[model samples]
Target chain A: PSASAEAEARAHQTQLTKPAGSLGRLESLAVAFAGFQGCVKPTLERIVIRVFAADHGIAAQGTSAYPQEVTAQMLANFCHGGAAVSVLAGLLDADFRAVNLGCVGKVAPHKNLIDNTIASATADFSSAPAMTAERLSAALNAGFAQAQQGDLFIGGEMGIGNTTSAAALLAALFHLAPEAITGKGTGIDEATLARKTQLIGKALKLHRDQLTNPAAILQRLGGFEIAALVGAYIGSAQQGVPVLVDGFISTAAAAIAVALQPTLAPWLLYAHLSNESGHKLALNKLNAQPILALDMRLGEGSGAALAAGVVRQALALHNTMATFADAGVSHAD
Target chain B: PSASAEAEARAHQTQLTKPAGSLGRLESLAVAFAGFQGCVKPTLERIVIRVFAADHGIAAQGTSAYPQEVTAQMLANFCHGGAAVSVLAGLLDADFRAVNLGCVGKVAPHKNLIDNTIASATADFSSAPAMTAERLSAALNAGFAQAQQGDLFIGGEMGIGNTTSAAALLAALFHLAPEAITGKGTGIDEATLARKTQLIGKALKLHRDQLTNPAAILQRLGGFEIAALVGAYIGSAQQGVPVLVDGFISTAAAAIAVALQPTLAPWLLYAHLSNESGHKLALNKLNAQPILALDMRLGEGSGAALAAGVVRQALALHNTMATFADAGVSHAD
Candidate 1:
């Protein structure tokens, strides 16, 4: 945990003008950054946001409000710098890229779109496993290779009906009811939400016996983008880079990643608590308190991008604020 | 509210890439800004932070951890750009000014220091009223005159024993116990906290008969800085400029301001939920949900400075992002 650096940062925090621990989460965030960077003063200059896009076969069950083809189209929008995440990336001046792991339709090639298609689409998990073991390994490797050296890494997802897959996976892993972990994705109506829950329940029942390990669960009930996010999280931790986990889908992937490697928890920082119904449960499971609670459900690392600004502010405050001695301000009695 | 502008902003929100109500507080902030600016696309280009500094006579009763002299010393540090809020103002590129409403010690003249001293210090409210009616009017006038042509206004306070005054004022206004509203100020120990509580209880009992009016409450129990902050909040609303209310002590002032003008609620935006105990109750009384919950107890408008960045980002996204039709992205079914 870089105890020396953390100790140095804590001492520095105390020396600042404000009372000790008054900065709250910001203080803890600075200390965490110090431990991660292995230095007394941490900087958040370079940030990289990787979005993994894929199509979920569960869309055929009328689970999502949007069509499956919207996944590929949104990738085009992201490359054209017209999406919400694209604008946020520009606002934050962070590097952004989209990886097309799988899409139901033909995705037109773009300069920033990395072609790492494991399959056109996963099989409907309600009837069968989502992907084969080989496909899962390739997706994980592709995600692992996407990690680059940066001050912070953000892994997000773009997939139609992926929330159903995430809910199925979460329900199976936690041995909870589908209704307890399912929510309307992309603003689905009440009936669609019920059907989505039923679909997740069916998927969980179909693969309950086979979902013994993380990889097996990914193969049985996870989307390609979800699996890629898990790999990216683990890979970033292995490289000693802190990753900001985005909303519901990304947090589900984080759940899987942490289950695979419990030590990765320290390397993860949750960005925001989404308004999606199941996100609260997922965040509770991870024991995470997010930086923002903007109710942002758009999952292209947008929340992470906004949270990057908060982290930058934390670093700026930690590094720049004058000490009480330097400012000649009186200390507490 | 500007109905036309609010409608335009709401319609623009739906046309954006994210789902309806997904951006949550951000969307509401944008709409609020739009209504305030009387335009569809509002901006936060100019921000002015007004910090009111004073010394409380209640410090004689050992209510604060720091000496009353620290208020003047911190004012010097603020002018030299060494304080936390000073650094944050520099970071946010906002105009910063410190108004010495009242201070116990000699404060040197500085270019950025606004000398609006109503008195040398407020009287100890545990025994008597804090200020005369004439002094209260002068303090309010000084604060009301501080408002200028800025897109956003922030009211912060710097006083050693101001929390005690705030607690006493709150207890008198709400008819609650002093223990329900008292908290540790500047990192006080348990003994000091209890002493502060008892002092507040004494002040409330002393002012119980004369606390019928808001101005009466301020005159009896509020510090000079607190009264000025309340004036600034009302003045900002009267000027049609949005005010970002800071942490605990500032919130107490806000409560008094809101009580004076219920219509001013629409013009106020809460910045953060502070670590101070009474802050939550005050926020609940105002029916306000702060933008950030950073546990920051530093009350020199620091939280408001950080929240300005969020307001800026919201404006950026509100003004720049492409609509669904512009991006050729499919809409939800």
Candidate 2:
């Protein structure tokens, strides 16, 4: 990020026709974009969204509302432009694709679906580590490759029991109890939620020693898609592209990525506060303020896609609105 | 609104590829538009933005940060495509215009500027009624005339001390003290805000008996732009067009419009929660849930224009997204 460019943009905002600071967070967002783009006026014309789909062995423990096969089904849906993110990507004219990291069910090939499978599914974390170190490395490399392009990057995840993995990851990283961070995955009832929490609690205890570091915690409790998301976030920021982080599971990835590389924090913008109960607590841990709060919890980059429109509007107003001198309007006395 | 269409849309949302209620407010927003358009799927293609510029009588009390001449200056800015709303409307491709209800300074003729002058300005409400019944009626009719076209209507106000007028009207209608509803207008200092609050308190006491109904309170304390907003809101709903109400001033107008005709509430959607302290209280009194809360306090329908993009996205998803059967995806089990 360019500090000088951010300073220049902030100074320029005061001269706009409207009252200074009246545009609120939008003014700050424009300034931040300017810094990221290293220009006074930044544009987000080319947006890229990559939805990583895999299966979590945690689903075998009955931690998800949907069957594990839904992951592969959603991948096909994404490729066919039927998923939430797919529809949004079409409307936004975004460069979008689905990466099949690994799923329990077979996914058919399509132009928009990228094959980057490491395993059919991760091992169930309740009884064992989710992935071997080599599998984790391959997944991270796959995600990192996707972050090579686009003006803005949005990383979305699809794994049936990913929320359980994310909750366990956050609980260990934040040093919180499982009950505090665990939430219903898709739409689990009270009994399932409690069971999910208990399962995560047991997994945390089983992997307490191995959870000493971010990557170790991720290997022990994170799903393949989540680790990929973490890799993508780091790569996007390294390439000087801002990443718009999605909901609960995606935020968990961001948390790990930022923890691993603190400098990467500046390049990630949270999209929205999700319907998941732990999302707020997770966001607070990172001191991140999301763009919208429509109570959305769909995990296919939809929230981030929705926020892309807002960020575009912010940049448009910044780049096009006339200054006080141009408008011949009086400034505050 | 067609209740049957709304119900149909709600059911249709459940059949889409995502989980039920996963889209949160977007789902309900699409359902609401379905009702308003009287179709299972609705579109928001033609958006209309009308900014009413007038001078407030209470500027005589030094309640605002800018001079009263700014009312006319902003009218020219709006026409020249330099103001915040002008830039937003241009980006949104909205049908945009500025209506000059009444201003202390003379405004030049422009293609996008409509002349509807009722007086040089209203009487100082601190000493007398802001506008007579006849002038109020004329202002409302002028605003009503602007609401005849477009799929959606957005009413914006541009006046130096209209927040003072809005605050006073809200206080009178809600039977609250000025201290409860008064806030800084365009970045007023502590001294100016305190003086503004006390001035409104005295004005309310002076008009205690006459502030009986919504219209009486409006005539006694409202600016011409605010009254026009009220008319535009009512007019838009009457014409079967939905109205996206702007910030504090616009919400105040919506409050009066909804109170006068309770059925008008269904056609109105709150755009954003303003940074102004009184905006939340006013919205709550009207049972409004604004779509965004970016801490924006700029009037002139910028917030509504920003929200139009989100609404359009929602409708697009509703009208085009494939159902579970189409995607061949399984439902939650």
Candidate 3:
């Protein structure tokens, strides 16, 4: 956050394992942090995967075909590292951690529960609902502290009907119409699309008064998880650690992070392009092209995890390959 | 070829740099030569790129407008190892020695002469003009002796208006109409195509009496190089070494080899698909898929050299990467 820290991040970038320009965009990410840390081989000693999960009260509206139980089931899977992101972090040799930033029903504190309760899901953020300013700041701090142990961190999200909440937030914050951004989150039929659209329309009008910049928008209409992702990115960047950004809902969190601290944008790696309509918009806003394009639409950081292979290959090519001169052969000279 | 020598060839493939079935096709190739020399690592001691060149006496007939000198110049480049095939063989650590099997005018021999003129070129084969039996047998003997030192061999071609010869070969050999197999050889225009088609029609009529099987086909109408490739394939198979088949023209040689000795099919590794239309037809007839598809159209064993990379990677993946059980990772079952 300080000018000195920003300068430190830039200095570290020049000292990474490969040449200055070879790794392409990956170089940009490592350098942004290196300048902050001011060291070569700035070890990514830990890789905390921050999962912000919550229950959406909008499930009562029947907007999602999936039962709300899937969210908590996935959250439990996250805790056990049985989810796709868990497998990915293990492959990348990064640390795996989760947080129940906010959830509904009778909740018990699980291991590594970074931040708990802010009351379920904020009344759907569609009717008379939004998080208070105090609750929002607390969520942000909880995720930040958890990520501080890692050299870099990856942010993941899980929640049924979270897409509905994200759509509302995007509309209220960016002042975009629902149709331009709204897309089928998970096999929504035409009838469900109309229903979701109308719901977003209503949520935007109610939250319009509270809508300001990203910080105010999150405090009013954001979830406990959204605020935490913003904090995770900032915390990771502040410590000179890069963050692997996942899809759609994670992109929404990324947009919020960027809006809050425009400087944190350099620390982010756009893992993969999702088939989700909002993901393209978010990627376009961020100006990122993902590595793989298998037409995947799943969102538990699976795309990001797949991209780890591409990034690893990029690093290997940059570092291991002998140049034409090194091989003592003329390279089409 | 003695019965015992042939039996020895049948007994084993050659020993490669790695384990059996490790490099898959490549491993099979490296070992198949064991029968050739009756040794484990059947060394390719007698290396010769049977560069069967001819002036497509049809060129003198004005079927091709380019001066016959272009073919000689290209042949010079091939022998100098400055062409693409030379660079590729260098990558694979292969010895690419050339033989001037045939070409227009006189090719004076210094030291590296394998076989010289087998007639300036086959008569256009359009007016009872084809190779005499004595000349065809001499070319075959030269190819066999040149390849006999070790079973492994590669054939390259550089003959202006040779595509016309190839089309006639394909038509007579496969019993097809000229239009069914004709293509833009050496980037000829439509007017040239019309003249070429008519020229082929005349060759078909003239060679109609010699449209027998593979041997008669060679003696009656095929060029010195095509005959040499046929001899080379059979010669290698007889010696018990695997042969790396190049492109369409070579594929034609392979088809003729198959027609001669059916067992030779297993010894052939179809390297890469060529952009030549005839190559696709030939590959389809042979029931093969090439290893790579970089849109190669030249015929100098370039495709085979490139396919070596795929073979190496496949071998590495099969032999090096730790399996799920080996790594102590849980399997899906």
Query: Which model scores highest in TM-score?
Result: 2
Any residue pairs clashing in model 1, and if so which? Answer: none
**For model 3, what is the error of residue A92's alpha carbon versus the real structure, in angstroms, after optimal superposition?**
2.3
TM-score-better candidate, 1 vs 2: 2
lDDT value, residue A52 of candidate 2: 98
DockQ of each: 0.72, 0.84, 0.03
Quality class of the docking in candidate 3, CAPRI style: incorrect
lDDT, candidate 3, A42-144, per-residue tens: 3344556667787776766877756665565556555555455565566567666677766654334567444466666655666665667777788888777
lDDT of 2 at B44: 88
RMSD of each: 1.3, 0.8, 14.1
Sorted on DockQ, highest at the top, how do the candidates line up? 2, 1, 3
Q: Report the TM-score of candidate 1, chain A only.
A: 0.98
Question: What TM-score would chain A of each candidate receive against the reference chain A?
Answer: 0.98, 0.99, 0.84
Report residue A287 deviation for candidate 3 (angstroms).
2.5
CA deviation > 4 Å runs, candidate 1: none
Residues B117-159, candidate 2, lDDT per residue (tens digit)? 9997888999999999999999899899999767799999999
Estimate the TM-score of every prediction.
0.98, 0.99, 0.51
Question: In model 1, what lDDT does residue B161 have?
Answer: 89
Clashing pairs in 2: none
